[model samples]
Structures are given as C-alpha cells and as structure tokens.
Target: MGVDIGLEKFLATSDGVLVKPPQFFKTLQGKLKSLQRRLSRKQKRSKNYEKQRLKVARLHHKIDNRRKDFHFKQAHALCDAGDLVFMEDLDYRVSAKGMFGKHLLDAAFGQFRTIVKYVCWKRGKFFAEVDARGTSQKCPECGGEVKKDLSVRIHDCPHCGYKTDRDVADGQNIRNRGIKLMSTVGQTGMETACADELPGVGLTLPRQVSQPRKGKTRKPKK
Candidate 1:
C-alpha cells in the first residue's frame, strides 16, 4: 500500500482509505493554555508554582503519549492491511516551517512515518520510501503532469480522464513509483530478509514473533 501524508487528512492510502488526523495537541490546546496561564501567574520556586508547573508538564507529556500511541496503532494497522508499504521520502521539517506549521507539527507526519517503518520491520513486512516530488501534481493513470494549486482537492487528469481525490491519486502515484523502484533495483537486503521470514518462504516463527507484546515484561536471564 502507498500512504500519502497530508494536512487535510492524517493520510490517504492507495486502497482508498482516508485516516483522519487526531490532532491530539489541538484537542487539548485550550486546557493546556489555561494551565500555562495559571503556572505563569504563580510566584517562581514556590510550592504552588511548582505544582502548576508540573501540571503544564504533565499535559505536554500526555499529548506526547497520546500521539505516540496513535502512531503505533496506525502503524500496526497499516502493516495488517498490506505486506508492502510505501511512503514519500520528503523531509517533513521543511514543510513544517510553512504557514500550516502548527497543524503539521501537531499531525507529526515524520514521527508517524518512522513508526510505520518500525512496525513494518517488526511484522516482517516490506517497506520503502519513494521520491515525493510531483506526487500530488501528476496523473496516476496516465503518468502525465496535471498541475493544480494546493487549494485543489480533487485530481482531474485531462489526458487520461482519470479523476479521484487528490491525496488518493498521490497515494497511487507513490505506489507506482515504489513498484517501479523495486522492479528496477530489486529487493533490498531488508526486504529480502523480511520475505525470508514470512510464511511462504518455508520459515515460520512463533505467532508472538510477528505480534507486538503488550505491557511491560522483564527480560529473562541468558
């Protein structure tokens, strides 16, 4: 599956699935702001100030934890949906400096992509990052350039008459690029390793090997 991360939605997959952004920080923004106000009003180094400071810190931590948890769950879900997953290789930091920086930072596209890669590795699934240029501007069907502004949410290809949601088309284009890349360069060592460990390769491990363990567990002595 090809996944296109965007501002409007958290992501859109080539399979026509759209995952909405949870915006964890945004949801708690007002409360967080109030906490910060209360903390700022308290005298420095005082007991009440320290308590309020901790409250602010805890809210930040809560947002971080929620975002991380969401990323892990979505990553596993993506792995379950496809054996091979592809995403854009663009640097999200550059985009985060733009006008929608706050929203982009809240969405945390880079972190989610990293989690997805890790989940794919843990699950013995194939994962690759493809060139991101023109993903949203090109036609997935005809491979022709179909230019449009950011405001344009739908992809309309005049050459091939292909039409679809802009982000979904981007996902398909990413998928196409990944397939081409794989065909041209063949599988990387990582992909080959993953393939070898999967069922069809005549190698099998315990079910727990492919599934993430829940809660905390102590490591056994060697």
Candidate 2:
C-alpha cells in the first residue's frame, strides 16, 4: 500500500481508493469561537465562568479524540490489508508554514504517520518511507513527467496521456518505487546464494518477470 498524504483528503491509495478527510477542527471552529465568547462575558473566577471554561476545554478534548479515532481506524485498516505499506516522509513542519498551514495542522499528518508506522510494525507488515520530491510529479503509468502545482487536483500527463487524481498518482508512484527497491534487494540476495550453488548461473540475470496485467496501472512500457 502506498499512502499519499494530502490536505484536501486525508489519504489516497495507489489503487485509486480515497479516504475522505474528517475535518473535525474546521467543522467545530465556529462553535468553539462562540463558546469562548460566551465564557468571556461570564464573571471572571465565578462558578458560571468555570463551567463555561470547562465546556470549551471539553470541546477541544472531543475534537482531539475524534481525530485520533479516525487516524487509528485508518491505520489499522491499511496495515491489516496490505503486506507492505509505504509512504512519503513528508515534513509537516514545512507544510504547516505555508498558506494552508492551519488546515494542515488541523489534519495532523505527523500524528497519522506515527500511528501508521507503529500499526504496520505491530502487524508484522513491511513499512518504508521514500523521498517524496517527485512522486507527485511523475506519471506512474508511463514513467513520464507531469509538471503540476498545488492547485492542480487532476493530473493530465502530457507525456503518456495518462490522467488521474493527483494524490492517487503520487500514491502509485510511491508503490512502484518501493517495489523496485525490493526487487533490487531480492536480486542481490539471490545472486549470492545462486552463485554458490551453480557457478555459471551468476553471469546472466533474468528480467523482472511481471504477471499478465488487465488493469490500466501496469501498462506495457513504451
């Protein structure tokens, strides 16, 4: 499984499934502001004031709990299904400094990453983090380039004529890259063992045999 973290939606998987973002904080912001205003009008240090103050705190706690519950459910579901899970090691600090800083913070990408890593570890599934730099910009189908900015939600690849939701393309790229890395590792291990068992077999390397494909994902290379 490859997970591409996003601000709009919580996650988009390589398989084209999307996990809709639960905008807990954004949804409750107005109510919180109203509670704060109400609390401000109450006499300072009085019983009524204390009660209103606790109400505000409780709202905050509720938001936190809901966000956490969503994360855990997502992480558990992903970890339970995939044999290997990969994601980009995105820097939330940098993301949080940009125009959508508040939105990103409310989404809490860091918290989700931690939960996913632990859940995968606890479930005995392989977990890997790859460089996120070009995953979003590359076309997963044809290994072609597709330049896009943050505002571009749909990816129209000029090179391969491929089209997809941007986050899904990113997730697909991450999964492809992870599989390539694992192939390299597996080949390295096999070369050593095969060389010892059979002398001449080490000279020629076999191609990366792929299964017969029916999906658009694994198009034959151009």
Candidate 3:
C-alpha cells in the first residue's frame, strides 16, 4: 500500500482509505495560547513567572505526546493493513515553510513517516519510499499528465476517464513507483528475513525478528 500525507488529511492510502488528522496542536491551541498569555504577564524569573512557564511547557509537552501517540497507532495500523507499505520520498521540511507551514509542521509528516518505517520493521512489514515528483499530477491509471492546481481535490483523468480523490491517486502513483523500484532491484516481494538480515529486500519477515523489549528488567546477581 502507498500512503499520501497532506495538511487537509493526515494521510490517504492507495486503497482509498482516508485517515483524518487529529491536529492535536490545533485542538489545544486556544488553551496553549491562554497559558502563554498568562506566562507573559508574570514578572521574569519570579515564582509566578516560573509557575506560568511550566504550565505553558506542560501544555506543549502534552501536545507533543498526543501527536506522537497518534503517529505510533497509525503506523501500526498501516503495517497491519498491508505486507508492504510505500510513501513518497519528499523533504517535508521545505513544504513546512509554505503558507500552510503551521499546519504542515503540526502534521509532522517527516516524523510520522519515520514512525511508520520503524513500525513496519517491528511488525515484519516491508516499507519503502518512492520518488515524490509529480505524484499528484500524473494519472494513476493511464500514466498520462492530469494537470491541476492545489484547489483541485478530485483527480479526473481525461486520458483514462479515471476518477478518484487526488490524494488517493497520488498514493497509487507512489505505490506503482515503489513496485517498479522493487522490480528494478530484482526483489519479488516474497522474501522472508529479519530487518537486520535483509535490510534491502523490503519484504515481510517473521514477527519475532524485531520485537521491542517491553521494560527494564534488573539482571540476576551472578
């Protein structure tokens, strides 16, 4: 499966499933702003200032934790959905500087992708990144150019008469690219091995290969 990440939605899969973004920061922005406002009015380095600052800090931390938790759950869900997962290889940091910068940063596409990759490894699913160029502009069905501006939400391919959500088309394109890349590298996508054993194979492996340690356990005295 291929995944497309965007500001409007957290991600849309090639399978046509759209996962709405929780936008944890945006949801809590008002409270965070109020806390910061209170912090600003406090005298610098005073007890009140310190207390307000910590409140603001805690709110920020809460947002981060919520976002991180969301990412992990989504990652695991993706791994569960498919044996192979693909995402566009793009520098989301550059996109974060645009008009929707705050939303993009809040979405944290890069961080989410990293979490997805790690989850795929842990769950024995294959994960890969494909070329990002023109994924949304090209037709997933006919490989024809279907030019449209950012305002366009639907992908109506004139050449192939293919219609679908724009993000879904992009996800399909990414999936095609990943499959092509795997073929180019001679991977049949059926290999089974631990991530450490065949890092480049990009196929499902046994679940026990990368099980994470659950807790810190003290060693018995010799």
Candidate 4:
C-alpha cells in the first residue's frame, strides 16, 4: 500500500526498507552560492553578465530535472512492486506552506501519485488514494477516533484500546478503506461500483472489469 513519506510513526513500524529522501535543496543551495559569486563579479545587464546568468539558470534546470528523476524512480519502485498502492492524498495547498512548505511541496506528493497512476495503468495494476483527513487519527481495528496533536507520535486509541505506530495505523487504515470500498461495491452487486476501485481487499488484485465494450457492432444472424 502507498504511504506518505514523512510520517515517522508509520515508517518505523512498516515491514520494508526506509530510504531517506534525497535532498535537492542541498544541491540547489550549492548551485545558488556559486551563481551569487559569479553574479557579484559581473557588471549588471552586460553581455558577460547575461551569459553567466544563463549558465546559472541552466544549472537550476538540471537540478530540477534530477530531483524529479529521483522522486519518480523511488515512487515508481514502490508502485510497481505492489499490486495496489495506498497513499495519503494530502491537501498540498494548505499543508505545503511556510519554511518546510517548499521542501514538502518539492517532495511533490501529488506528482508522485500522477506518475504512479500512469505506470499502474500501463501495467494493469490498482492505485488508490486514501483520504488524509483522519487517517492518522483513526484506529484501524475498531474504527476508534482519537484527537492527537502533531507531537503525539503514538496512536493510542481510547475507544478500542488499539495502539500502534501512527504511520502503520494510517497505512492500515488506508488498507481498510480499500477493503470497505470493495465491500460497498460488492454489496450492491453493481458492476460499475467495483469496476474501477481496487479489488480483492488487501490482496492487491486488479479491479474487476465491468461495462460492455464498444466500437464493434454485432452482425445479423446468418
């Protein structure tokens, strides 16, 4: 399942390897410092000044490309290996603000999903977006809700007494949502409901196909 990176509680308890996200800022900061030195030495608007400016811009361009490449590779690796992916669908506009905002935005959680989605589509896999609003606070076992401040790392569910690594709970909650969703569609026995959503709760099987095909007409009886 897809889990948002940065939720330390979930990652710590998760069953897989944790690779620290690459730092593009470190690379950009170095490029900017060098550019500043060159700009300081050049006369404003002069031909040489413009050339140096373009060089700096080119470096920035390359750095951006590299950052995207890394994110895609990591995200693709996660998405490709799993039959289904569950990840937080964060409100980037609101969540990505302030000092760490740019860094968080740079993580481009949204972009990661987009890339993962296209790849999943190509491979006939399933991709699901878990709502982030209460995922971190809800108990996976008994649907208990807990109010927690950001500093509270442990997910202590008062109602159900279910305790877990917060991120793991969120991940499990995400997985549970996928299960509930399948149940809902399956209950109705409506092919449309189950057709697109990820299928086979927790098994990572692709969603069942529904709806009749088009583009070819049946011939009259011989």
Off by over 4 Å in 3: 187-222
- Could you give candidate 2's per-residue lDDT for residues 1-222 as a string of tens digits? 788988777899898889888899999999999999999999999999999999999999999999999999999988767889999977899989998998988899999999998988888989998878799889999998888888999989998788889999999999998898899999999987777578565454357765555767765898
By TM-score, how accurate is candidate 1?
Answer: 0.83
Q: What does candidate 3 score on TM?
A: 0.82
- Give per-residue CA lDDT, model 1, range 17-136, as digits (tens): 998899999999999999999988999999999999999999999999999999999899899899999999989899999989999999999999999999999999999999998898
For candidate 4, write residues 23-122 as lDDT tens digits. Answer: 5766578678888799889999899999999888887787778877876676667655677776666666676766577666656666666777777787
- Backbone clashes in model 2: 0
Per-candidate total of colliding backbone pairs: 0, 0, 0, 3
What's the TM-score of each model vs. the native?
A: 0.83, 0.81, 0.82, 0.71
Which pairs of residues collide in candidate 3? Answer: none
Total backbone clashes of model 3? 0
Clashing pairs in 4: 2-86, 10-167, 10-168
Residue 48 in model 3: lDDT: 93
Off by over 4 Å in 4: 7-19, 158-162, 190-222
Q: List the global CA lDDT of all models.
A: 0.92, 0.89, 0.90, 0.69
Q: In model 2, where do residues sit more than 4 Å from their true spots?
A: 191-222
Candidate 1: worst-modelled 10 consecutive residues by lDDT = 184-193
If ranked by lDDT, best first, what sequence of candidates would result? 1, 3, 2, 4
Candidate 3 lDDT over residue span 143-173, tens digit each: 9999999999999999879999999999999
